[model samples]
Target chain A: MSTVEHTDRGPLSREEMAAVVARDIPDGSYVNLGIGQPTTVAAHLRPGSGVVLHTENGMLGMGPVVTGDDADPDLTNAGKQPVSELPGASYFHHADSFAMMRGGHLDVCVLGAYQVSASGDLANWHTGAPDAIPAVGGAMDLATGAKDVLVMMTLFAKDGSPKLVPACTYPLTGVGCVSRVYTEVALFDVSGDDVVVLETWGESVAELVDRLQLRIARATRPRGPGRLR
Target chain B: MSRTQFHTAAGGTTAAEAADAALSASGVASGMTVLVGGFGMAGMPVALVDALIRHGADELTVVSNNAGNGDTGLAALLAAGRVRKVICSFPRQSDSWVFDGLYRAGRLELEVVPQGTLAERMRAAGAGIGGFFCPTGAGTLLAEGKETRVIDGREHVLEMPLRGDVALIGAHRADRAGNLVYRKTARNFGPVMATAAATTVVQVGGVVEVGALDPEAVVTPAIYVDHVVDLRSTSGEEHAA
Candidate 1:
């Protein structure tokens, strides 16, 4: 949180955003990537990185997604989609799988979010729509359990409202759990008291601050319990 | 017939009826709580649930990971108006039309528990623990009225054990002693559900002789199992390793 470190480059594509998250994840970390876009991080991980994937269903050494001929109905990810298992993969019951999460055995968990409060509260599970059927899978457990909760999402809604807000309007999934946020437009560090702009793309810190209507400073350096720290 | 294959999926009007007869013989009465094992269709006991439909045990309570997927297994039972309530972690999946429709129409009751808490509740029940505190759902709507205390620096909520009248689980193989071994991820919920229920009935791919199974590989020891339904005819060897 210091000078106006600005940028005018184009916005990062979905793959680029995923790559940024991949680059940040340290090797040998036990991580859980949320079902959707967060799953893309797997493709960008380095070969032999030793970053073991933790599927909430009941596995530790999960590998790439498998489809068609290679897909086995018995081996699937938390999303219930077919996936491969690495050499060291092991399976257990549901309780033990979740125990890894609740017991704080996970190093990092990257998730997709609808809204993240300035104080790092997350609300991605439900929109509170009366007609919608609610499903709260492992989202709450990961948010509360991971050593670092990183969110990957678009900076703005389709209607152009900002997703990063002073306080979340939607129902919260977890309170003060998010440590960092990676968006297509910028990377933010919310682990501390202030929301620090680590870097920006397609938009400058000045424009983001104005549009977001919140106080943000250019990060002197990334801070967390990981390699970036 | 071997003792392990005592109740085979044979002799009935339909597989559902035969399965229902097994359920009936095991004292599965109406208005009881049943824990249905699976995480989607992986470890789901389809034959057993199809029997529950023919068993006609209305006003029954069911606990599982997902509610239903399509109009088969759990969905068929739910559509038959057998389940009065569903206690699950994630009920609304891509193919959960039966549950979605019934829920919207006010014909079903639902209690959504966090996946970790749901499993731990059952594990606690089997282990003889009354209740324990954890920090999975603190400060969320799910933990609204629950009792809470600050453990160390984090807030933890008290959760109680969840027992069942009966448990229906699927496994890859079992020995004559009723020792069970599962295939891959299908093992989810089966081991814990086995211990948390009063009478645990298992449907297996095949039954081996007493000494046929490797002693080190028995995931659910025979102590937790009460009945075995051999489905070796239909459970192809594709899942066997």
Candidate 2:
């Protein structure tokens, strides 16, 4: 039977999780940083790594966020946040940006998520509320077009609800699009049968479940693709 | 059933002539809303734009993705004071006189949407989906005055779709029957606006027989197209003439 194992520490700090996630990204990737926590990944990229950053507003080769007094108002990310330019950076028409995205030129895209299902379905667009302001930005295209997708989010909502669930009730951006997920509690791979907890932040399965007050099951074998519920 | 009268131009008309005939047939007048397709300098309906400007049209609302950089493209319309309002994603450039003057004076009624959402909204308008929701601009100034709702305790932003009476599109090639194909960056807003507008006019570099184009190469099918115009290059200056 497949057994679930536990680790010594409880939960990892946010910094630890960021570093761990950053380590997995390959060097020389063409990556699009989604808004929010994914934007922070730019600051954590290892030195000498040649990751090309793309903004939907037509800039490629963006540097990390500038601090102190070095920030240039003219240089900003898609979100209009001030940023520095990396060497060999260039700007083009916004049309060219989407062309790069739609043409399968991007290597990876990291995004924030509200929910990620065991089957790798992502629901970050809307919760389907009556008065909700809909802003389904390039997420649909990014979720479908990028070569690989990684989601960064907390293990649970502020109200203590699990963000990982059997099914997503929110409006999904793309079907079965997530490749991996990084959370403060664990690094998980969206396996076919269930969310396989690959690396725990020093906590046992039972203890982690208890602390988060959720139900978790151990699988005896690796679930094949398309077996996710 | 009552029917609207239609006129047909002689076959073998140049693409530019065909486009002019179609636009003229639409009875376009002053003070109309027209949506233009193209992203920045790529795939713009240079011929149709020139004709409209030369025809002395005025007080128009232009729905576009970006108001072109000054001195050419849609900026020409703004420069001529022909445009009354611009509903677009982003229309600002440092030295664009029309955009700067109207924006600073609040004379331009701008509806700013996220780039992706704007594309999808145009797509949704074309696809007949009324509205959709997303969280892209939640908690920012973009959230102001928008209807907000909480789903599962998380907030999302809502946006509505838009459609225009006339859509001016640029294409790399077209068939006599009006099937359109656009090259690289020019394809951005062309295909989407092609479907969402009531009248879609195409300007093309080359026009061929209907079936001569491969089935897969037809980016915007003829059903969405209402007219075709040919581009003419003159004086070592290529104008969508």
Candidate 3:
């Protein structure tokens, strides 16, 4: 058996995309990182940044991942993955943890999305497949509760279809909740019905705008991958 | 069914039989709503849940954080076809074949709620709050037909409190008076669910003396807990083992 190799146009890696998102979180901010790709954001936060990490599974000030004997089976994140706790970490009931979220106490939430409408709607929890069991979890709560919602995903699907669309076809998690999107290929900020290109990877901004037929507002020219280095 | 074996609450402590007796006496009727506590397998009241399943209640509406994982625990209850609808946050995970099969076959119904909202609704029910405003599902289908309000310049949606006929929960320890203390994250929904149900039965790892537990450490005070089962006893060990 042989594995096929392929190449695509992109500069920032997934880690770089996470770093790009992490750089925007201000000091003293309370943030929630959604499961899956968004969990990577914690590894890239600058030291002593003072960003408090909140997990929907009733924990605040969560530390990095714990492995081997150090892992506590009961001490886990919303994803049920074992994790450590930083100093001053506190635990609460599930209801109280949500009270923090729905009360708008979180400054930012970075999430993984399946589709994001140009108008900032999110469709990440379900694909509407007939056989698929939808897991909505805390996505809807984070979508609406966080002051600023940043979505992290690839620019397109594995099938080469654009995830950024005129309107989300899947069942939406929340409407007009997403403010910024960090993709493998580009960074865009979503307004009411327009997408502003903040940066593009290897692909030219004009090319992406033309290919996707995006109504683009270019705030600045695309930078090379070496710029981050 | 076994009225002779049942005993009502006197003081804070009820008969141990109440855990099973209350549920059994509730008649195991169809279309009943039950609140169960656990996140994965962390803090589930296994003995109480097993008793409920053995009682063979059908057409139940179970509210929990996750649909049972693997083939044991809540999954066993679900596999027995005792549930009609499940109100949960994450209804499906890698090992949730029972719910998936039943749902796909149209034998089951699901109401998927966000985790925070689910917790808050139960909290509201227990705290005696009529209803509260939340922004969690405001612009989504979950917000459809629900009242909307603008608070602090942001759109918020109304979510009503949720209550259950019975609550099955777990705790690390409990006093003779039923003051409950939980171990770490296992305490997920137990405290809130204890307050939201008409009859709350707790399965504790151990049952200590009346003054054994520290008052400050008690998460669910004796006032909220109706019945207690000590799962750490030799009999409980045999049942679980």
Candidate 4:
């Protein structure tokens, strides 16, 4: 596979990046979207896909985020934000909810990350900064328990430093758990023997390889009908 | 005292008197591990916590998912300076100023557990299991102080039981016999906390006849529940529109 080119398009919007992630999810996959940006993927899910959403707090078949009277305090997502339920929604206690996450029952879980290692280690919980109050929530559980852990984040930090590196500088959330890295700039395949470049936005494979400073291998598997051209 | 106390306490005439009777019988003394239920305010037992605050128990160790939300349920308790330590997963949220201030000032002790491990530890406690090896938090900073084991060639961390002195939970409805039914996603920590506590107390929207709740759909069975405060009439203002 070679670099994906969308010459007609400008920079990817937030919705477009979410649409990219949504395109990869196979039909009838059981997915769990983490809080913040990854939660936006639920908005792009194709209807009748039979993709049940699992929230760590306690819910399956969660509906899209709602407002006004539709927002019930009683029905909320993992983030503790108000949400409604779909037709087949079900609720459980925290233990069982996390059991679904930690038991490898979920097909895929998309999470936001601070940094991800080339060897598939994830670091999203705490930065290990002495002053930062540590909060892990279900990050470790989702990272460990999902069948395939997919991280959604920007490719670089604000300082223009790469987040996808040889090893994570931050504290780890999971070791060798991530399968893919979905970034604003490109999509990476970290599950296999090689760190394959699945797709890229405006940059070439050489550009990413030079910037990331990690070993890059050509695609070992054939490409699918990707969202980009 | 006992689960039977709910039935025999003052003949259980009205909801208020019954709620008062349930709170008084909670045995919420000072220096106890209190497991408060809810994810944010979804299934928060506001009335029970309010009663506990009125019960005047100090130096409590609370086990919950979040430290507290706004200055209400658990936050109010923290703000009252009654809590000595907090064992929760996430304590820093937008409205968690009370916990933030306390944590920064070194007035409170905190143990940040992973959410899944937090729940499973209580589940293990309730199930009478000592501890189990878990895959969550295996290689993280959270697992540093804990014991580690390898099962199936993958690293796992040992998680121990976390039973409570008393559990405060919110449910949608309950039978007079205390078999509870929770509403929607509000059933977050109610079921596990109910079983993990030495004395489990619940606050439900209504108290139905013993046969009103479907036996098949009851989440927390009556045997695990010790007392249920029927907040049907009194909890309207607490859960406003």
Task: Please write out the lDDT profile of model 2 over residues A1-229, one tens digit for every residue.
Answer: 2533436656767666667667777888888989777887777778887888987755789877776698554456655566777779866444346657756788888888999887888888666675443444566667766777888999888898889877777767666778778888776777345566656666676766676533455444453112112
Q: Give the per-residue lDDT digits (tens) of candidate 1, residues A1-229.
A: 4433336568889999999999999899999999899999999999988999999889999999999999988899989999998998999999998898989999999999999988999999888899877788889999999999999999999999999989999888999999899898878888788988887887777878888867886666334322443
Total clashes, candidate 4? 0
Off by over 4 Å in 2: A1-24, A27-30, A33-229, B1-20, B151-154, B232-241
Query: TM-score ranking from best to worst?
Result: 1, 4, 3, 2
The residue-by-residue lDDT of candidate 3 on A161-183, one tens digit each, is 89998889899999898988888
Chain A TM-score for predicted structure 3: 0.90
Give stretches of model 3 more than 4 Å off: A1-10, A191-194, A220-229, B1-30, B149-154, B234-241
Q: Say which candidate scores most in lDDT.
A: 1
lDDT of 4 by residue, A1-229 (tens): 5646444545468888888889888778889999999999988888877889988888888888889977888888888788878888888888998888888889999999999888899999898888899898889889999998888899989999999988999999999999888887778877766677777777666767888878976554374325321
Name every residue pair that clashes in candidate 3.
none
**Tens digit per residue, CA lDDT, model 2, B70-147:** 787677777788888877665654445667666667566666565666666677788898876655455544567888
- Cα lDDT tens digits for candidate 4, B1-241: 2253442212335554555567778888999999999888888887777777777889999999999988898999999999999999999899999999999999999999999999999999999999999999888888888899899999989889999989988888778777889888888889999999999888776667778988999998888888877655532333310
Interface RMSD of 2: 9.2
* Model 3 vs truth, CA RMSD: 6.3
Q: Which candidate is the best by DockQ?
A: 4
Clashing pairs in 1: none
Using DockQ, rank the candidates from best to worst: 4, 1, 3, 2
Q: How does each model score on TM-score?
A: 0.94, 0.54, 0.87, 0.94
Q: Comparing to the true complex, what docking class would candidate 1 get?
A: high
Query: Lowest-lDDT window of 10 residues in candidate 4 chain A?
Result: A220-229
